[model samples]
Target: MKTQLEELQTQLTKAKQYGTDQETLNKNLLRILKERANAERGIIPKKQHHGYIILCSQQLIKKDNIKYSEAVTAWKTQIQTPYPLNLKSSEIKDQIFKDFVEKNIFIEMEICTDSLDIKTECEVNLQQYLFRANTRTGYWEIELYTTGEITIPLNMQQPKKNATGSCSTFQKDSIKSNVR
Candidate 1:
C-alpha cells in the first residue's frame, strides 16, 4: 500500500505537469487507477485514495495562490504610466486594495495623509499575511500579530511652483486687469 501510494503521488505530479486542465488530469488519474486494478472488482481503499487526492489538492492550491500574488504585485508596480499624478494615485490605491483582498488580508484601518504621504497600520489575525510594497520609500507602517511593527518612509519632495504662478496672485491680477 505504501509503495502504491508513492507511485500514485509520482503519477499525479506528472499528470499535473502534462495535463492542461482539471478534466484532463482527472481522466488521466482515473485511467491510471483502472490500469492498476480492475475497476469491476474494486480498486484502492477509498480512505487512502482520498487522502492522496486531498494532499495533492492542497499543494496545488498553495502553488496557485503564490503565482497569483506574484502576478498581482508585478502589475501593481507598473501603475505609474501616462504622466498624471491623480490617476496614478487612484490606480495605486486600487491595486493595493485588490492585492490585499486576493491574499485575504483584512484592512482594519487605513489613513491617507494630506501631503501625498500615506501612513497605514494594519492587523492580521493570521501570521502568514505579509504586506509588501514596491516603492521602498512609500510611507507605511505595519504591525503583525503582536510581534512587532514595520515603518516605511517615503521620499516625497515638496511641490515647486513659481511665485508668480500662485493662485491668489493670479486672481488678484485678473481683478486688477478688469478694473484697469
Candidate 2:
C-alpha cells in the first residue's frame, strides 16, 4: 500500500508536468488522497490477477543452409532483449478486464518455439501483481511480476546492432507488463 501511494504521488507530479486535464487530475488527486488515508488506516488494495496474452517473436529465419567452414565464428554471442514483453495495449486491457477477478490476477503468456512465426502457449501462474495508473492517460499500467533481462539468440546471418521488434502500445486502461 505504501508503494502504491508513492506511485500515485509520483503520477500526480508527472501529471502536472504533462498537462493532464484539470478534471482528470482532480479525480486522480482525490483518489490519491483516499488511498493515502486508507494506507494510514492500514488498508491495502485487494490483489488481483488480470488475464492477458503477450505476443512474442518466435523466429525470423526459417532455413539454415550455411556450411560450417563458411562460418566466420562458431561461437555464439548472446543478445539480451531488454524487456521484450514490456507491452502496453488497450485491447489487451479490455480483454483482460472483461473477465477480471478481484482477489487474484494471473497473466498468461505464450512461449515461442524454434520454428519461425510459431508460438507455444504455456500457462504461467504469476503470484504477484504490481499495478500503477498512468497520470496523463488515466489508464492502468500493470507491471509484470518478473522484471529480469531476457536473452534472445541472434541469427548469425543477420547480426544487426540493437535489433528489437515493435510492440503494441495501448492506452486508456492499459497494462505496462514487461519482462525486462
Candidate 3:
C-alpha cells in the first residue's frame, strides 16, 4: 500500500513536471485509492476487485516499469527466504496487518505534505521482523517492511460549509478544469 501511494505521487510529480494535466489524474487516483483503503478497513462496502488496473487513468500516470527497479532491488536485498506473506486480496479487511499496531509494539507515524500547492507526502512506518528461516533450519532472519494505506493529511473530502451552505475552497475556474 505504501509503495502504491509512493508510485502514484511520483507519477503525479512527473506529470506536473512535464507540463501534463495532473489535476484530473491526481484526484481520481486519490479517490480510488482512498475508497479501496476504506473498504479494506471495513469503513465502506468491499467490492470484488477484478485485478484490472483502473483503466483510463493509464495514460495519466504511465511510468517506465524499469525506472524504480533499482530501488526495489535494493529493498529486497535485505530479505532472506522470501516466502509468500499471508496477504491476499480476499483478506484486505483482516486485521493481520494491524497486529503490531493493536499490540502497541509498532508506533504509527505520519508524514503529511500540503496539498494546496500540489505537494504531498505520505505516512510511512518501517517495521523490522525476525522470521524463522526455512522451516527446516533452526535459524532466523530479519526483514524490514511496512503495510497499510498512505495517510493524506489534507482532506480531499469536501470541507464543512457554513450555515449559508456555500463552499469556499473551490473556485468556479478550478471546478471547470476538473470537470474535464
Candidate 4:
C-alpha cells in the first residue's frame, strides 16, 4: 500500500510540474483520478479519448457498460487548475483524495462510543473516528465535541404579524411546536 501511494504521489508531483497544458496535465490527472476512483468505487477505465475517458467497474461493465462521465469531467477540471501547486495547496488536495481512499477502512473498525455522555440540558458528548486520506499520508482523528442547543430565527420560518391576532390558532400551535 505504501509503495503504491508513493508512486502515486510521485506521479502527482510530475503532473503538477507539467503545468496547465491540455494534453500532459489532463492525462496525468486522469491517471490519478482513475486510481483514486478505483480505490474508492472499484471502477476501471473502459476507453479513452482526446478530452474524455470512460470508466466502469469490471462487474458493471461486464453486465451493462454503464459509464460515469461526470466523474471524469470533475477529475479533469481539478488537475488543470491555473494555481501554482505549492506544498500547502497540494496537501489540501491530497487530503480530499485521502478522504476518498480511506472511506471503507472504517467499515470494520468498531466505534468506541462507551465514553459518550448526555447531559440534561440538551447537551450531548460525541466522539467519532474520522478517516482521511491524501497524497502524503492517511489520517485518523478521534473528534470529541459537545452539541449544544440549536436555535433558528423565527422570522425565517414564519412571516411576522403586526397584530398578535393575525396569527390563527393553528399558527400559534405551530409556533409552540417550533414547526413551520
* Top candidate (TM-score): 2
Can you write out model 2's per-residue Cα lDDT over 34-145, one digit (the tens) per residue? 3543333223341111112121222111123233434221111121111112334543344333333321222222212222233545332222334444343233345333
Model 1 spans with C-alpha error above 4 angstroms: 1-87, 107-180
* Model 4 lDDT tens row, 27-96: 5765565455333322223222111111100110111222443221100001111112232444345443
- Model 3 C-alpha lDDT per residue in residues 1-180, reported as the tens digit of each score: 999999999999997876656656754553565455434333323232211111011001113333564322111001211122333323332232332244222232231222122244434434333232323321122233333222222221112331111122112221121113
**What's each prediction's TM-score?**
0.16, 0.20, 0.18, 0.16
lDDT of 3 at 30: 38
lDDT of each: 0.27, 0.32, 0.29, 0.27
Worst 10 residues of 4 by lDDT: 72-81
Tens-place lDDT digits, model 1, residues 64-118: 3353644211100011111122224443354444433542223221212222223
Compared with the true structure, the alpha-carbon lDDT of candidate 2 equals 0.32
Off by over 4 Å in 3: 1-95, 108-133, 137-180
Using alpha carbons, what is the TM-score of model 2?
0.20
Ten-residue segment with the worst summed lDDT in candidate 3? Answer: 51-60
